[model samples]
Target: MANSSSTRGTSLDPRARRTRALLRAAVLDLSTEKDLDSITMSDIAQRAEVNRATVYLHYKDREDLLLDATESTMEGVVEAARACRLSVDTHALPDATPTHLISLFAQVDQHRAVYRQMLGEDGSARCATRLEHLLAQAWFEQLTAEPPGSPHETALQVRAHFLSGAVLAVIGRWTRGDFDGEGEDGGGGGGGNGNGNGMSVAEVADLTWALIRGQK
Candidate 1:
């Protein structure tokens, strides 16, 4: 009992937590402001006010650091998604709507650099995969009331995975500024903003849910 408490307390120590925050903030700040190719360990150290050696101790290379940063951001998104699920039941939340989802997506657009980096040539598909996994886990916990082998379970899981991927894909495109006529977001072949008005996350969310549920 003593040992377990000691371990837990150590993990919660202030200085140790601060060091991690510094390193994580340094990586994300640099990523947000510059392309991944241009960032360096020394640059991160300087931005973070830490030593290069310290950075090395926490991460193996630029790729590793970028991955770590991306995961950190996903934690919040996953939580929001989980909340979306809970809101559906605990509060008799209204059916998922496109407008609301699109608005959440627009918030993601606010971090174009981070999303772009995740989908860019130098970025890690692994980060995207893990994020999808998180979203799937949240959805599964809520959407699946039966055991895995039930008649409808497999189908639902597949649909969940597909929905998660679609969400990520749209966000990826948005980050790259590819929403053609999609307001300030990029667009190479994007159709005019949904319904010809300014882009909206709520609309996208509604559309996405429609697709996932096969609704008209």
Candidate 2:
């Protein structure tokens, strides 16, 4: 594995940035057609219209590039989830769309194909583990940021881990079309923009909030 420091930098030059983008795009495109394990550096380079050595210059290796792309997408997911925590009023009832929840879903939807492949049954364990680790870390930070709620440190850690795992599982299921259009949310289907089944994003948020608050 690469040290990350060797390949990761504070900033990328324009040409470097362009090349990186191309390589990333290539990986994403190829991922849709083939499994990540089968997709080699040569495949990525060819798709990106670059040389094998060029791909090496930008990324440490195939796994490194895949992780980079996965993290980039997860960044948006984490940002949206964090925003939902901060912005949504836990006290107040949820609206149909639930701004933050939909925003989170939209981020996933934007990269639906990538997520589906990575989170699928035959998905990469490394990618799933990385996502779980990041999610747990984010939730742990969120839990600790507020005033003390849990009596024991261990309990808090457990709760955070539980929430993170549950959330990831839900998202994975949703990507697999488990909840498509089916809104268990009592009210009518989507808040107009929801899926055909009318599952309101707010309903999903409320359910998540309920679990979170109950555990607290």
Q: Return the top candidate by lDDT.
A: 2
- What lDDT score goes with residue 157 in model 1? 77
Instruction: Give stretches of model 2 more than 4 Å off.
Output: 1-6, 86-98, 180-210, 213-216
Candidate 2: residue pairs that collide: 181-197, 183-199, 189-198, 190-198
Highest TM-score scorer:
2
User: What TM value does model 1 have?
Assistant: 0.71
Which ranges in model 1 have alpha carbons more than 4 Å from their true place?
Answer: 1-12, 86-107, 146-152, 181-198
For all candidates in order, the CA lDDT equals: 0.62, 0.66
Write model 2 residue lDDT over 1-216, tens digit each, in one string. 222336867578999988888888887888667666678999988999999999889888788888776766787777666565431123443433346666776676666657766877777777877777767766666556655453366655776677678877876666555565432222122332365453345555566666655423
The TM-score of predicted model 2 comes to 0.76
Q: Model 2: how far is 163 from its true place, Å?
A: 1.1
